[model samples]
Target: MERLQKILAGAGVASRRKCEELIQSGRVQVNGETVTELGTKADPAADVITVDGKTVGAQKKMYIVFNKPKGVITSASDPQGRKIVTDYLKGINERLYPVGRLDYDTEGLLLLTNDGEFAHLLTHPKHHVAKTYLATVKGVPHGTALDKLKNGIMLEDGMTAPAEVEYYDIDPEEKHATISITIYEGRNRQVRRMFEAIQHPVTKLKRISFGDLYLGNLKRGLYRHLTKEEVEGLIKLARTAGKPGNRPTPKKDK
Candidate 1:
């Protein structure tokens, strides 16, 4: 048995939080009776659940790794008709939510899944699932600025957690540089903001990896389902974060 919200989210009805709202609003019924309590649980297989009188059936969980191209919205839908990440997921029927968001102008490894539990586990702040990005900045960051990024930067929200930062390439003539940074926190436009704070705004950015999962060779706008082993490995990585020896220095992407 699982929580009713979990069942609804796993069935692709909506996110877990939205499903909980649906339950609280008296839209969900279990075994032909309305279930408005937040603590309600039911066996998904045996219980006939409905939302707005429509039956909710279990859906096969899907885990996909998408190489998100720039200029696409990270959301499942866009009102202004802008292309969204889901639009690139051609022929896949499952309603998969992005595990976390990448900026509309940012590109690279993006995880999508119908499994709410897995998505939550990976995205929770305490999990510290490291995400690595390669950013092309307007100016080459000097050692002092890089060190400040490696330590922490005070943002409007608060002092950001320490990040792993290293410069990969420097073009003196263009005054541009490419840097690889790994961060544990999932703040909005964090990488871009970090550089902006250092007075070297990012010109381009691409996420190269999330935890142990790498974007590797996957062309932009293409996607592939995660192998069982890969999915399991991500779960283990998130679950074991903060334990002794679990925090290793992030490797720079070649």
Candidate 2:
């Protein structure tokens, strides 16, 4: 049994802190009785739960791969008044959120899901989920600059782990080069920052591949569910790279 508030929060009802307020305000009920207790527990699968008179049930777990278009925010909501990725998924019934994050200016493959455990597994750094990107930068980084990126660059938090970087193409006249970079670590704006460190700012960044998943032919703003094989591959990869004490045991999906 899990705390009622945590269940509600995990269902995207509200944050845990806000769920506490909702409970205290008598807006929550369990098994047809108003529950104002802060520490109320309920079996999400069996309990009759409601919030503000609307029945609350366990949401169906959904996993979707989206070919995210540029200029759309990855977040569910943006205070800065910008278009969000959720706006494109209007017909979808499930309330899904982007698994990790891709900046507004960056584009390409992104995963969206309501499975909190799966999201945690994919985003947690200890999993070492590899992300590959195709970046077009202002300058062609050669020799020493390439070495620095491949070896590792010192960031504000600490030194980044070694990355795989190779040139896709170079246009000397335009002073730009298309480079492929694969990173196992996810820090905030890491790909962009890595290029900036070498004085070769990235003009465009698109994640081409993530683990065993790829953008394929999915058009921008379109999404599709992962195949059974794809899901199994990801679970295996996560288990292999997950932290020593926190590795997730593979479970059969119903």
Candidate 3:
């Protein structure tokens, strides 16, 4: 299910914000019941939605979980015509776009959806929906350095919000450390930048999870439709994030 304004907006009835105004003014109805609340959710395909006595056309909301391969730009299109994420979604009929983005050379879990509200909620910093990444770095940062990273780091942009940063594995012989990082903000190259500020550069990076979505056994360059339960799990998280005084906390490992 999706927001009523999104349904009406997708049907070419009006802009999404205008649809909300229509809902507040009692000009919209769902299955014969007037819905004036802005947060009310409904499935456009299952419900008979109307705006100002006009029927809103049916549109299916689509979601995809993709193991984005390296060297693909996470965007709808690239000006230089380089390979893009949509190239991997060739057969998809819906105009699904990436929820946030992964850098061109970064790989791992990425979400694609046609729902604007869902995308906005997930990516917005105020919502504080955390995204996770696994990074291989050169040196093992210990003691106060780890504490500095966990509390907050001073990047060129400014001080970042506190992150759940830890070393899941460290190979002293190989001089390589595998770090698991959970961050609430989506700053540009924030993960790599965080490590850099601590004097441990990120060698390779992959997003392992976004909100409740995980990569699991999905291999690289692969894509799949999110299961019903997975979708509902995200919706529930969004509801919680919407509450006043909701703050981003370090999520416990599952």
**RMSD (Å) of each candidate, 1 decimal:** 2.1, 6.4, 6.7
Model 1 lDDT per residue over 4-103, tens place: 9988988878777788999999999998999999979999989999999999997889999999999999998899999999999999988889999999
Q: Write the per-residue lDDT of candidate 2 for residues 64-136, one digit (tens) a residue.
A: 8998999999998999989998888867977778878999899988998776666767877888988888889
Considering lDDT, which of the candidate structures 2 and 3 is the better prediction for this target? 2
Expressed as tens digits, the lDDT of each residue in 98-196 for candidate 3 is: 888899878999998876566666776777776888888888887588778778889888998887777677896858897888888889989988888
Candidate no. 2 TM-score:
0.79
Best-to-worst lDDT order: 1, 2, 3
Tell me the lDDT of candidate 1.
0.89
Q: List the residue pairs that clash in candidate 1.
A: none
Clash counts for all predictions:
0, 0, 0
- lDDT scores for all predictions? 0.89, 0.82, 0.80
